[model samples]
Target chain A: MDLVFFKIALALYLGASAGYLVFLLISSESRASVGFWCAVMGFVAHTLSIMHRAIFSGFFPLATSFDALSAFAWLLVGIFLLVRYHDPSPIFGSIVTPMASVLMIFGWTLVYQVTEPLIPVLRSTWLPVHVTLALAGNGVFAFMAIGGLMYLFQERLIKTKRLGRLHRLLPSLATLDTINRHGLPFGFFLLTLGIITGAFWASSVWGSYWTWDPKETWTLITWFVYAGMIHQRMVLGWRGKRAAVLAIIGFGLVMFSFVGVNALLGGHHAFQGANRFMPPSGL
Target chain B: MEIMVIGLNHSTAPVEIRERITFPGDHDGAVARMIGDVEGVEEAIVLSTCNRAEIVVTTKDVEESRERLIRTIGEIHGQDPSVFRSYLYVRHGADAVRHVFRVAASLDSMVLGEPQILGQVKEGYRRATKARTTGPILNRLMHRAFFTAKRVRTETGVGSAAVSVAYVAVELARKILGELRDKSILLVGAGEMAELAARHLNNQVDRPIVVVNRTYENACILAEELQGLPIRMEQLEQRLVQTDVVITSTGSCDPIIGKAMMKRVMRARRHCPIFLIDIAIPRDVEPDANEIDGVYLYNIDDLQAVVAENIGERRKEALSGERIVSEETEKFMHWTKTLDAAPTIVALKEKLEHIRATELARLNGKFADLDPAQREALESVTRQIINKIAHDPIVFLKRTGAHGKQNLYLDAVQRIFRLNGAADNQNEGEEL
Candidate 1:
């Protein structure tokens, strides 16, 4: 039943994403609303599917690498729905729906689907808190990155003397900049709390507050990059192309920390036994 | 009743004829009352905006109403009916309803998608209602026109783009800077073009507007008119840092603002975005200033190009608006056609009842020897027979009428029953 819901949710998200892309091409107000409702329905089903996994598995769906990816995608969709509920602009969905869908596909195809029992160190209440905060922070950063990317696209067209379709489809540059400006600090705050919770959980379980594991190291790097971007913006008035470029770079590091660090480098955080799930047939 | 419009718009009449035919705005209600009192006119409204003069009415005869309307317009303007005959355009029934909807939606406006026409039409409806010259048909038509206008506005982007150079500058500034409520504006000269741009900004930008000119006295006058501060031309460098948008339309032969000077200002302002509109003929700002990273400089031609592009887009959106108007018009026409069946149905029932009553009275004389219960039964049976006979024709009239074939069906039913006079006065109290 959980798998059925997951599959249905994936299909909805894909359809909604395609609808939003078509909306960008057509640029109709009614079509935008239609695409928006499709995304909202998909997000709702996706949430239920995640809840289904948690209820049946007897743990929060944040332990295995596959669970982590699914949880991250769920958080991304949740944030998007929240943003769109307030903003109601289809441009945000045009970027976020695809991102969440891609993450979901990766989780479904590459990782083991079976819900693993919580390993001893992962059984604490702090574990859920740490994972949820970290995933939420990643979701916020992804949203900010989308805003940054849009700002760059709009700015480039304006610079190139081409005020055409894309220029009209996208939101104003000020609105996109405001999103990045607010999302940066908010994401940083969540990441800070998540890091603190991880430290506390680590001390209680692993007998150390700091681990320097590959995942841990890359997460720190991602945090620093975003923190630096925020600092430059607030202190030195970094904006427009410079701020957008830095945000994209920061989001790149965030993606690496969330996905690449776990898949490529061995880490204690990889609780689903990554190599065992790897297909025997090489690419 | 029939709904009709006889009018002359920008396309049909020259300005001189339009002015002569237009009703005075203050006396619009009086004119509507006068038109309503005309023979065959049941309800009337006179919409006489600067660009068009139209008299819309619910009437008993389309051809008679058109003649009366044309003569009334000519009399009010003290001209002969022949002078206004060539410019007059007349439409009745569904075509008239569509015309009203199109006018309200701004699809039939002189400038397609202009916003003021909807408000002007509403004002006309208001005057008619105030004068007690609008009945159910005109009231319903005006309400539907409003709804269609709202639908077109939301479903299409017809009125969303700016179509003038000054308005384009404002739109572009809003796009770049989001809200201009907190952004200060600097007018580079007291020229007419610069003052026009400043006037456009007055309603939008709430911050102080600073006007500068070579002659300080002219600057002061323009500044006072704009409710802004007047500064000397030497203060241009100082104002550039403080202002977010600068509109330059000076009459100087050379470029007033140079690249090197803008580069210095960008550095001082920490590279914050600044919008520059050079609407001057020869261009007030140097073209090289456009190359600066933080400066957005649009010349007169560039602003005109954007306006032209936006106008083209609005025209495209107007096509969709036209579709919405047509769809709504069809629905309204169906409703009115269904309404047309009511009087015919009444007339048919009255004719059938008269025949049944006459036949029953004749039978009563022979049945008087029967008991009271038997007489009652006979009367009830005869009434049922009459109802059964009238039911099929009534249903057919209403059904066919809703498809806009009511006139043909109604004519046949009336001729077969010889009930034309019976329904004429009854329908006068109802809608068409």
Candidate 2:
């Protein structure tokens, strides 16, 4: 029941993302209502599956890093769909939905390798709080990247005067810039909190507060890039175009470090009990 | 008081006059200061961008304020006030308010749906607020304009497609290369158009920008502004091999980077594609340079074709943007209309409350000696009468006044009971 609901939820999120992308290109008003409702349904399904898994296993469901990542992406999609209701610019999902899909897909790929026992190492009271915050931060940064890319693209199209068929559906560089402006601070705050809680968890386990691990370094770099982008935007009066591009680029860096580093690199941040990298018994 | 707007926008004024009077910053602080000094101007804001200079003011008499404002703005541009009198437009009452809302929402921008106007409006309001001249009335209108601007952006496709010629140049490069960060862009001349194309490259990636110009100083200046490095025109041959893109717009009679140099470039770069944009009129680079392998050259005519295609999309978004403005404006006007009646309604309600309470007090002592049951029943009957009396008149005032028929209805209610009696002491609720 748990796996079935999880698969259904994943399919819905991917479908919603594709639906929103189509709506962005053709931009019918009706498509927006469809995308928003689909995302909402997916979120409900995701939450149910996670709860069912937790109850069946008799723990808070922090057993595997991949499972936690999957849950977080689902949460991000839910939050993203809600925010999109308020500002349904196609560029938003252009940056956001990809992050949700990518994280879930990566986690799903490791389904066989990941281990999730409801033991003491994964049973800290702050486990849910820490994981939720980190994923929320990821969601926010993903938006910044999208807003930035749109800014750069919009600036170019305006200069070239070659705006084509789907061009009319894009958000204004100024509007994207504003979303980036507000989105950065929110993303920064969440990532900062996530880092702090992760540090607390680390101390309780690893007995060290600061380690220069790949995950730690990359997340910090992501933080600093956004921090710089926000400062350039607010205090310097960077306004629309420049600010937007910076946001998109910043989010790209975040994704590269998040999915690429975790899935490809066999660093300390990889799933603790990952068997995927191990050689096959016969081979 | 009437809402008054008088100034020249991109449609009415040229860039020279706009440049002179633009409140791009508190840059000169000239336009902002002059608007405040105009007589009968209670609250004011100045919105000046490359395309327009507009002054939105809350005033007692728009005609007088209009004349004064144009004169002051014209003076700032060192023109005789009468010369620009023909170009300046004057909108008053609801029209003036609607204009500001539309302009701030970017429905009136030169590009139709460009989004910078909202930030520009915010900057103007911020400056006015700093000067302490922008109070509640201007604040409310300005804030409503901002809300409308946001709605236009999200709910409508006001600024969707790339419209301007300069932006089109940059977008084309992206489509060809996938990403521009690591690519090399070479500017062939020292012209402003070349500099503009470079600015569009921006800080998307960590790649360096190279500018090769005939004049070292011009290249240096542009390079400094864009944080790029300058290379001399002598290196044109060598640079072409390394450069991925070349943009040329110059006044020179002959081609700067011709077919010979471009052919050499194609072979050296190993058939790596390059984009050549010629914006100059007499043709800076030769047209046949495109015949060479891996050279994707676009002249002004090709660009215009793309611009023509963009027009239909821009036009479509323009209609969508306009629809958004009309809907948002109606919603805002509804609020203002209701607000216009609220003060008098409050005063009328207060008068009724005072009379009802006094009559209740008089009856209170008279009924004190009666039985408790009898007093309670009488009080309930009196409360019901007060409700019935207040209901019909209040409902009548709200319904009639909101639909542009407030004058007679307001007078009738005021005369019947001499209610809102102090209305004569101040200006009537109708804005001039």
Best by DockQ: 1
lDDT of 2 by residue, B1-432 (tens): 567888778888776666666544464444566687688787778877777777888776777877778777766667777666776788877787779888987888787778788888898888887776665567667877877777667656656556666687776776545467777877767566666766675544356677767788988887786677788888878888887767788788887778887787776775556778887778977777876644667877777778666766667766766776677667655544534456657767777778877988877867678897987887778777777887887888778754534544564555556654434412322221
> What does DockQ come to for candidate 1?
0.43
True contacts kept of 1: 0.47
Task: Locate the minimum summed-lDDT window of 10 residues in model 1 chain B.
Answer: B423-432
Cα displacement (angstroms), candidate 1, residue A179, comes to 1.7
Which candidate achieves the best lDDT against the true structure? 1
Kindly list the per-residue Cα lDDT of model 2 for residues A61-125, writing each as its tens digit: 64566666776677677667777777765455544556666777777776433244544555676
Q: Measured by TM-score, how close is model 1 to the native structure? A: 0.85
Q: Rate the local accuracy (lDDT) of all candidates.
A: 0.81, 0.68
Task: Give every prediction's interface RMSD.
Answer: 1.9, 12.5
TM-score of chain A of each: 0.93, 0.81
